[model samples]
Target: MNTPPSPPGAERTDGSSVRIGVLAPLTRPGWAEAGRHLLAGLELAVGEVNGAGGIGGRPLQLLVRDTAADPRKAAAAVDELAGLGVAALAGEYHSVVARAAATRADALGLPFLCSSAVLDALTEQPTRWVARLSPPQSRGWQLYADFLLGAGHRRIAVAAQPSVYWASGARILRDHLAPRGGTVIDLDMGALTPTAVCDELVDRRATALLLLVGHPEPAVSIVQSVRRDQRLTESLIGAPAGQPEFAEWATSLGDDGAAIPFLRYLPERLSPLGARVGAALRERLPEAPSFVAFEGYDTITVLADVLRSHGPDRALTADSWPHVAVEGTRGRIQFSRTPGISVWQWAEAPVQVVDRDPAAPDRFRILHAG
Candidate 1:
């Protein structure tokens, strides 16, 4: 095994190190906590790899940058990381940021592994140095639609804020459910109050309401308002894996958070490794590890595996990633070389519908597995 020399800023006096650049929304308004969870998972994986003698006797060090969920910031971060000689890049939570970072990574010809961005277009084309562990937004919506119809929901009304994330989710749901004898109603959450939104859905006789707000506070408000109405209390209130998976969302909503089902990357049953990772994460994080944390951990572990097998050569790592498969905490971390989705994309990660326990907001129950 011919180990390549360490990149520019990665060579230490005592020993060589492989610097992995991590891009996350560490200080972003709506995504601060998500970024923290992502960083924590990455750090945990790096610690483990270093403890196990690292890759080829070179310890892994994370050079983290806060993208603030902004595309321009993400691009700048990539440039900085490249300048610092990072062997690979990973760990982004926002779709917009991930897309920008992916483009930059390809341009620089550096291997980049996306942890949790779900936009279908991110990996729509073949690229030299890009792959995603998270399922695309379209795939997630497919699972959500399946769960909804299986749970006997027909007249579905979607209330979503105006954002790329919300719009993509809403579009997928409408496209999947409309042709299946399901009535799909679209409401701009920005234009309606929680009360007005509830009234309109009730008037339209909606059996289910998909609250697609990105922010936790407003999502909780809408859920609370809708549940307060006696007419809407029986309605299946659901969110599309944004604020719903966060602990703060459930805690702020209190007892009202119960029974509000949401799509997430949690499997129906945790693997032994997944359980151990979850337990380890719980010790460090204020909340139990969510899907974002799992993504970060898996991304680093997969990157480590690639580095160990391919050495620190950027081109070799990029070329070899497509054939590399690692068992991630969520599931198998493998990429599909399909035409449209031309990357190493794990599109079949198990997603499930889960709801918070009213008595234990930190706990959740899997309602439906997809």
Candidate 2:
């Protein structure tokens, strides 16, 4: 006989706890390490909120579902979580997965505070039901572009898989660099082997290589090949999607993963609150936490504040995006309608271009900040 399935997230029948549904990539192909850190931040914030009296003493609880980086899985999770009576929804690390969850949450009229996905067009149409803490892709990638140009790179090549996020990053670089006498060559990772990528780099004379692909497979292979290539010795490798932010990259590639500048949302100095949370997150996670963990903490903090000031009613919580004024681990958190973005975005989340020290893989060095 098959084991019975566990009922999702609707654990409290008496309505004593205010539930917030969490969507994350906790399994394979979903960047599980990032998911772990994101969950850590969310869990930490919930504990603190409960300790301080949660949502007017009712307590806040998280019902987490693993999206595993699948858009369809995330959409289905939104439906299930909304039906299970969550007051709000939060947490997703992958851009495409978050987009799916945001669309579904908007359709169901469930309030969603997106934690980490930065896709600019989160929803096809603007809706008050979703707010985001991360900076949009366009802004972050353009800043990454600025960093490349500042470092005297003009001829660039991107090794990319078939992904909207990858395509968008390539497009952003091409658009930003074209007018400034810079050129971008796109290499299809689906067709090109890692050696082929190095060969293409040599033939094309591209000075820089960007990895706009997934982690640990193609990305790792490509980096190893490029690092070992004698011809591409002087070329630079980059990952603007923040692939090197996690410890796994360092563990997987060692010094090969270091010095590959990527975009990260962080200030030069952590706030007093950020400092405190950083210590707490360090204790919670086995490895040092990424900015994603901070994003997760800030997500619950904002949602808890919304519930306290407005109420747990979904409509009011959705409408409360404009009134959120919490001090997040990153910086002051607030949202507004950006011109092209379809959701309320935290307009002032910090952005930086950083890379690990080749000498000390555990230490990050800020190359550029904006």
Candidate 3:
């Protein structure tokens, strides 16, 4: 159960292996598949690195732990991995888990890099032990705002899960709309009843909706409610999670709603690295892939690069490296310089507006591409 020790350049002078821990949601209710997808990406990265003669010829090993989207589990997992003496820690899509792990990592003085968690609060701590490789939620909001403003939607309603990311984005949207003579109506689903959500949307008379739910049921319910009562026919809908399932929901509600999904990378086509990642994922899980996959891939890639460049002996603290710029499956990645530094420079891929075709429920047509 002994973990790998750090060397001068993350190299093993004594033939010791470098253990990097990946903490993710493996058994969470709606996120099991996403967790699998993320693991698939990590597998590709490790396999590729090991196949290419390992990190500094010492072979890199991944220690996988299931956080189950639980903060306590996340903290406990870090304790276990830390006891094993892992050189570094990598985070997942669960921001709460990232926050918890960051706290522990900071206390232990271990370098922590976040791959997918985008909540701004994770980086608000005063320590330089954590670095986020994913862009902040604010950037995503700016993208959504730009998209909405360009589409001529002046009156907008934001429907979110009342999570950290959504709540922050709602405020940013409201602020951004203030100068343009536009209106931003905020809806926190966690506080209001589903029926109340429907009533509020109808009352706002908003011309567009920004949905922030991460699952299928709530998303579908919101759409149905909006369609049944709210005058959203002429309004545009934007979400970061508007996948095929949401389109199906729109069709089920008999609403030909326009949808825009703000994703991590632009261009729907896969990159060379993405191709390798996809193949690895198909072999491992063979189900639907989500944005978490890319997050995991980028996390490992960046960690490997840093470990290789810095070697095992150099301290891998957060302040040890101010920024990381890597070419991922999407594009260039640079961590944000915000005071708390919650976001990363992971290039958000182009957003596309898609609609569910009445003739083909499972199919979607791209009306716009960013």
Which model, 1 or 3, shows the larger lDDT?
1
- Put the candidates in TM-score order, highest first: 2, 1, 3
Candidate 1 Cα outliers beyond 4 Å, as residue runs: 1-15
The whole-model C-alpha lDDT of candidate 2 against the native structure comes to 0.91
How many clashing pairs per prediction, in order? Answer: 2, 0, 17
Please state the error at residue 325 of candidate 2 in Å. Answer: 1.1
lDDT of 1 by residue, 155-183 (tens): 99988777777788878888898888787
TM-score of each: 0.92, 0.97, 0.79
Q: Give all candidate RMSDs, comma-separated.
A: 4.6, 2.3, 5.5
Better of 2 and 3 by TM-score: 2
Q: Which is the better candidate, 1 or 3, if ranked by TM-score?
A: 1
Write one digit per residue (lDDT tens) for candidate 3, span 1-370: 2222222233222447878877777774425556666777776677788888877897887777777777787788788877777778885767667888888877877778777766667744566667776666566566657667777878887777766656777787788877977798877777876567766766777778777776565766766666566454555566654434332344445543434434443347778977767666667654435556766777788888878877754265454446666777766656545644543334443445455555754455554555
lDDT of 2 at 192: 93
Q: Number of clashes in model 2?
A: 0
Pairs clashing in candidate 2? none
Question: In model 2, which regions exceed 4 Å deviation?
Answer: 1-10
Query: Residue 65 in model 1: shift from native, Å?
Result: 0.9
